[model samples]
Target: MDVIVNAAASADGKLSSRRREQLAISGADDFARVDRLRAASDAVVVGVGTVLADDPHLTVKDDDLRSQRREDDRPGNPARVVVDSSGRTPTDAAILDDEATTYVCLSEAAPVDRRMALADHAELITAGEGRVDLLRAFATLQEEGLEQLMVEGGGELIFSLFEAGLVDELRLFVGPKIIGGRDAPTLADGEGFVSEFPTLELAAVDRLDDGVVLTWRVDDR
Candidate 1:
């Protein structure tokens, strides 16, 4: 399966400040590009924190693009995948609005009630004991015939995927704004590398109307 991670960060490499917020880093052009990417993908993924913080719809929103996808015999919208290890995703989250198929990946220890509630709006899949086992989740996605997955992030999810060697490509849009804070979230945030380091080879760079988008391929070999 091909896994692509996508994000738009500030000039200072911050996704957002350490405040209650929904960061508007991407511009209209970037959003249209993202919609095209979403239309091309089999599934669009994000962490539960993204849902709790931004309440994004996580579906293809452009009418013409949606029409074009359907004309091409594709799904009107890609399936929505949410990684919620502890099952913290709200039942009313925008991703659960039935705009598309929703998969809630949870830990094995997720509470039964929470699982049941989410099941009303999503298909629940247990991937790990106390956190999401991304490899298992990928296997499940592949089994479901959703091989082209796009992971949009809220830091933790991106870090986990990168750490697990699941990310194949990364599309980072660098905006002009700089939200500098020691506590601000970044593109990849977790217990970062200490000894051995991973690298991403630059594949392409394009200047958008409001920012520059850089594409990199993870070179784990």
Candidate 2:
């Protein structure tokens, strides 16, 4: 099982300059590739901010992909997981619906009542405090028969995972347009660029229809 991150950002490196929630600049082909990636993964994970801001269904909606996701259980769609340190995901969010098997990972400081409420709708895992412990999250998912986790994230999630050496592969789609926002978030933040992880190295690069794709691997060394 691997944790793969897929995302598109502006040439100037802002994923969303329009709003924190809106990815208004990605091209249609990027969307298709994203769908394909989702179709292939065993589970999809994201930070709570993405869940709260986007409220995405996280489903592969092409008719064939949809059918493939629903049949045979194991071969079907990936379960949905969210990293929610505060346990603040909305009760009405699509992840809470039973149609998608959902899991929420919370930090130790998250309140018991909130965990209980989430348990009413989804499986709850308590990781360490301040951030989600992705290693433990993966172990929990493995127990549920999920492999090949894809993380579609807000900035913090991506940075933390990269820092923790939990990421196996990273897929970045660089959109053609440049957004010169002063406060835009990078996939990794601040001195994060200065501090190298134990074994991260470039794997491959390709140009997509409207963006460039960069694939990286966190080597075991």
The CA lDDT of each predicted structure is: 0.91, 0.80
Clashing pairs in 1: none
- Model 2 spans with C-alpha error above 4 angstroms: 70-75, 190-193, 197-200
- 14-128 per-residue lDDT for model 1 (tens digits): 9998893877888999999998899989999999989999988988989998899889987899999999998889888889997889999999989999998998999988988
Cα-lDDT of candidate 1: 0.91
lDDT of 1 at 123: 90
In Å, residue 203's CA in model 2 sits off its true spot by 3.6
lDDT of 2 by residue, 1-221 (tens): 77898888888887676457576566777788899898888888888888888898887767688677667555456789999988999989987776678889998989888988888898888888876787787788888888788888878888877766678888889888777666776666534656455465898888878668888787862
TM-score of 1: 0.97
Best by lDDT: 1
lDDT of 1 at 57: 93
List of clashing residue pairs for candidate 2: 69-77
